[model samples]
Target chain A: MSLDQSFVGRTYPPTAPYQVGREKIREFASAIGATDPAHHDPEAARALGHPDVVAPPTFPVVLTMAASRQLIEDPALGIDYSRVVHGDQRFAYTRPVVAGDELICVNTVEDITSRGGHEFLTTRTDVTTTAGEPVVAVWSKLVVRGEA
Target chain B: MELPTQTFQVTRADLVRYAGASGDFNPIHYSDRFATKVGLPGVIAHGMFTMALVGRAVTTWAGAPDAVVDYGVRFTRPVVVPDDDTGTEIVVSAVVREVTETGLTRLDITATCQGDKVLSQARATVRTAG
Candidate 1:
């Protein structure tokens, strides 16, 4: 099944808040082998002007990826999860995510196209605090391979 | 200007750790049987995991952990990981493509796994430390 082009430009409701935890950030950093003290130590992050341990730039994926489930699971979208492959990803940050921030994601379909027996869907997710402070904008492109 | 290259080791353990951390439990990144059933050679590394490593390279070059203002990448090839302890290696390198007057540095990044390009059009805009 192909992605619905009509869904392009449609913005979904904001997701439930996700609390950014210091231990989660530290675990993510450790998984990536990032040894930056600010990612692990609240003191180091505070020294760098952050209120608590700061997350790596890619940490937002943990939120946006899950948030995109809203779109991927939409019956109108008709996405075949088994055939979907991640094509591209991007993140633009106003500031690094610090521990304790309650973040929400609003996903919007940016584009949908078909080519070479594949359907491509691009979604942009705006991440913000519950107080409406924008934290980051994330874009992800998923390619659904046509049935063989 | 060319930035110093950074290489990251991607082991099966690392992928498992990343999968748990990122909440992406895709079997293609862990179970060889599932991956092969789905037409992959074997268990593969998560594309986001590779991007995370590249992000590490970018922030390290900028000399600040939180310097990246923007980052993006297109996955070109999967980094296939064997079941061995030494899964694979991704080498990340970048060149300063441009510098803005407002202290932003645009970088063109390249990430390779076993001499094959895994990511294309990888780039980052960073706020350089003044």
Candidate 2:
């Protein structure tokens, strides 16, 4: 089934503030084997001008994925979680996220289209500081595969 | 010019670690049964995991942890990670696409697993360390 076309361009309310933690950044960096000192050593990050430990480029997904649950589990939108596969991901950064940042996500449904019995839904997440500093914009494409 | 290639190994263990760290508890990354039930060949690595590996390569090339200003990728294929020790390998290769007057460097990236390109349209813009 195709996604609700009316949902396109619908923007959701901002999420609660998510505190970016030092330990969490370390864990994320280690999980991917990113051994750059700036990801773990606050002093190293400070030398680079970041306020605290710097997160990897894809780290925002950690929070944005959780924030996007608002749409995926929307009873009205009715997305099948089991049949979903990721299609594309993009991140444009105004600045790299650091450990001390308090981030919030605003999710918007950018587009929805169906082709070849598959439905594609693109969601753009605008991540910012609680103080409204734009951090980065993340875009994700989820494909819902049709049963044969 | 092509940057030096980097190779990273992905195992079910790495996926589990990533899942816990990223809060993505998708069964497809850990349970082969659920993966095949959903018509997948086997437990697959998370798309984000693969992207993170590529990000590591980008930063390594730029010599800075916070170098990436922009990054993007299209998941064209799954990296089936086995439960064994040497599960799978992702090879990342990139070429310098352009250097802007503003000092930003753009790279066209490629990630392959088992000889199949797993990510397409992969690219990154990084502020290289002077």
Candidate 3:
């Protein structure tokens, strides 16, 4: 089934503010096997000029991916969550994320295409502070595998 | 004070184990033929798996298990894992970029395979205990 092309440019409402926390950063880092002091130690991070412990680059996945539910669950979009497989991901950042930041995500469906009996969905999520400061933009590609 | 970097060889066993743990079963990551057919030089590791290694490097330094709050990366290139004698070696590195008032720290990160930067412009945010 083809996706609703009309949704390609639709922008969803801003998500509830997500407070970035320190321990959560540590957990994400540990889960991915990151062993960098800057991810947890204030002194070490301070040495590098950061205001607080920094998160691993992949940390946005924890929230943006979760926010994807808004689009995936939308019946009008016709996305089949069960058939979906992550195809690729990319991030563009104006600055690194830090704890104490109040973030809200705005999701947009960038494109929809079909090839080889498979559907491809591309979504972009923008993370920003409540004051409208842009932090990062994440683009994700999902492929819905065909049933043979 | 100093950037953290580590290099280690990845084995087929490591890839298989990560696949099981992460629940990602892309044939190109495990099947040589599938990988070759898909135009990869050989089976390649999952980008997230490599990213996971970067996270591990950070957590090891943080000394805590659950401190990461924000993380993001751009996949500049794919890590092509060849079916050869030497396997693959991945190097992970990070630098402290900034500190925040609420005890949050930010880092610049990178993931390289051999000499190529498979992932670039990576950054993360972690919080400290109050």
The prediction achieving the highest lDDT against the true structure is: 1
Worst 10 residues of 1 chain A by lDDT: A1-10
Residue A93, candidate 1: how far off, in angstroms? 0.9
CAPRI band of model 1?
Answer: high
Give the higher-DockQ candidate: 2 or 3.
2
Q: Please report how far candidate 2 places residue A91 from its true position, in Å.
A: 0.5
What is candidate 2's lDDT per residue for B26-121, written digit by digit as tens? Answer: 899999998998888999999999999999999899888888999999999999998898999999999999999889999999999999999999
- Among these predictions, the greatest DockQ belongs to 2
DockQ comparisons of all candidates to the true complex: 0.92, 0.95, 0.16
lDDT of 2 by residue, A45-124 (tens): 99999889999999999999999999998977768877889999999999999998999999999999988999999999
- What are the lDDT figures for the candidates, one per model? 0.95, 0.94, 0.75
Instruction: Identify the runs in model 2 with alpha carbons over 4 angstroms from their true place.
Output: none
Residue lDDT tens for model 3, A11-90? 99999988988877766655555567887787777776778877766677667866888998899998877676666676
Kindly provide the TM-score of model 2 when superposed on the true structure, using C-alpha atoms: 0.98
Q: Each model's TM-score, in the order given?
A: 0.99, 0.98, 0.62
Write model 3 residue lDDT over B13-126, tens digit each, in one string: 667766654445678788999777756688888777777676666655565434566665666676777666677888888888888888988888777887888876677777
- The clash count of every prediction, one per candidate, is 0, 0, 56
**Can you write out model 1's per-residue Cα lDDT over B1-130, one digit (the tens) per residue?**
9999899988999999999999999999989999999999999999999999999999999999999999999999999988898889999999999999999999999999999999999999999898
